[model samples]
Target: MPEKKLNQKRKEFNKEKMVGIWSLVSLEVTDENGQKTYPMGEDATGFIMYHPEGYMSAQIMQSGRPQYASGEVLCGTQEEMAAASNGYLAYAGPYQVDEINKMVTHHMAVSLYPNWLGDTQPRYLDIKGDTLEITSQPVFFNGKEHNTKLIWKRVS
Candidate 1:
């Protein structure tokens, strides 16, 4: 192999090593419809840490009032945010990193969400430095679609 090619491969390998444990510090979500937008503040925040043991876990809190499957938007209530995120805490199972595709896939989600209560496909992963931003895109539940984002910071 050429020296340049070997160096490139080494760099790619190094980036994967950076995918270790991380903690959640803060997060913000924006719901946009063309020109109108809303910021779901700090309620949707938590820590997510990945282990070399082939598993990762996350806990997220809904910060602002966002619509739930029950056809209700919390709208400026912490209790509502907490209730909305009841199943979002302590989700774990296994994960895989795809460097060439710039993707990370999570499987077997032991989460509170009924839709993800069992094995699942890769939902989201965009890692850079000490931050790993993962999202579960809009999914249709009860004939409605909702988009969400979860952010975490490296602690270990």
Candidate 2:
């Protein structure tokens, strides 16, 4: 977090380690008092992929989302569509890794949430064996600041 540390080049950390598809394990949000909660339920499912071409994509959602009564993809009414969006998140864009900081920055060129479009977010990355842990910077939402930690496992 220091200024000098940010300028140092990474020695052993390689950006290549991040290139792979990962299955979501868990996403935990912790508040200031250390109380943790799951934003998409405890058994949420999703995938995050880091492409070799310096790009990344992540899609996450609560499992067992209600299906529209029409059984059609595009026929969902406003209420149905809003419910779907409320339970899902997705984004993709070129990414950059700052190995010194053990961080990866997701430049949101596109996202399901409009506010995230063109937003750049830095996530701390810790990869061990086949597991990758990405911790977000403190985020203020839902009336409180929280830290989110997402765990993932390599699938390919």
Candidate 3:
């Protein structure tokens, strides 16, 4: 077998492994001091979808968020919006999977957090059966560096 053919095969295999809807199982952030926290509360609900065509989107939100009094996006008070935004994280864009490196880089085209827009976030991946665990590289969150681990289970 040729080396190029082998690499192509590997890439195809990696893409296949990621093409599916995955439900968030758990999300944990470990800070430099080794303290673990769930920024999205104990019960976070989210879904991440990977398309064979190399696009992806993700949305995660902490459970039990308070409802807006006006029930309108524009009518939300400053504190309401801030609370909502703090409890939710969403982004979508094209993605690339490096099979050899076992990493997935998301080219964020849009994100709820403005700072993340246009950023390329790379996550180390470990796929096992129905479970996919992605670990973000050390990221500064709340003035401290933390590594976030998101566990997902294949939904379809």
Candidate 4:
């Protein structure tokens, strides 16, 4: 085989290797302090559905009871939290995967962060059998870049 052909085949193989729905059967996210890690409870499960349509669905379980935010913003302000508690249980979205870079970029979200409507976030993922290691180098939250790491195990 020609050198160019061989390279192309390698690229194709890498792309095909990462195509699938990786469920978050289990998860552990480290806090900003980095001194401790938080593990999701048994009820804390989610899924990331990757589609050939250049999109994906990423959803995570809500914590505790519902907490609805006051005003138009889905996220309740400190004041709003005191008024009512109506949040969410689970949310999903569309996404695209760049196999070459091992990065999965989300196109649109259907839950969780509504402000991320059309925003795109690229997540670096390392998959080992049913286990997945997700590292978010600098995710902007509340106008601050947060270093986050997440590990998930496939239950289904």
Candidate 2 Cα outliers beyond 4 Å, as residue runs: 1-11
- Deviation (Å) of 90 in candidate 3: 0.5
**Candidate 2 C-alpha lDDT tens digits along 21-83:** 999999999998889999898999999999999999999999999999999989998999999
TM-score of 1: 0.60
lDDT for predicted candidate 3 compared with the true structure: 0.93
lDDT of each prediction vs. the true structure?
Answer: 0.60, 0.92, 0.93, 0.58
| lDDT tens digits, residue span 1-156, model 3 | 799987885864487898999999999999999999998977999999999999999999999999999988688899999999999999999999988778999999999999989999999998888999999999896899999999999999
lDDT-best of 1 and 3: 3
Q: Best candidate, TM-score-wise?
A: 2
| Model 4 CA deviation exceeding 4 Å by range | 1-15, 31-33, 37-43, 62-93, 140-145, 154-156
TM-score of each: 0.60, 0.91, 0.88, 0.59
Per residue, candidate 1 scores C-alpha lDDT tens digits across 94-147 of 887765444567775687666777766665566667677766666554455555
The residue pairs that clash in candidate 2, if any, are none
Model 4 lDDT, residue 49, Cα: 58
Q: The CA-based lDDT of model 1 is what?
A: 0.60
> Across residues 61-132, which tens digit of lDDT does each residue of candidate 4 receive?
534634554445567776566433232223456666665567777666565556767676678877776666
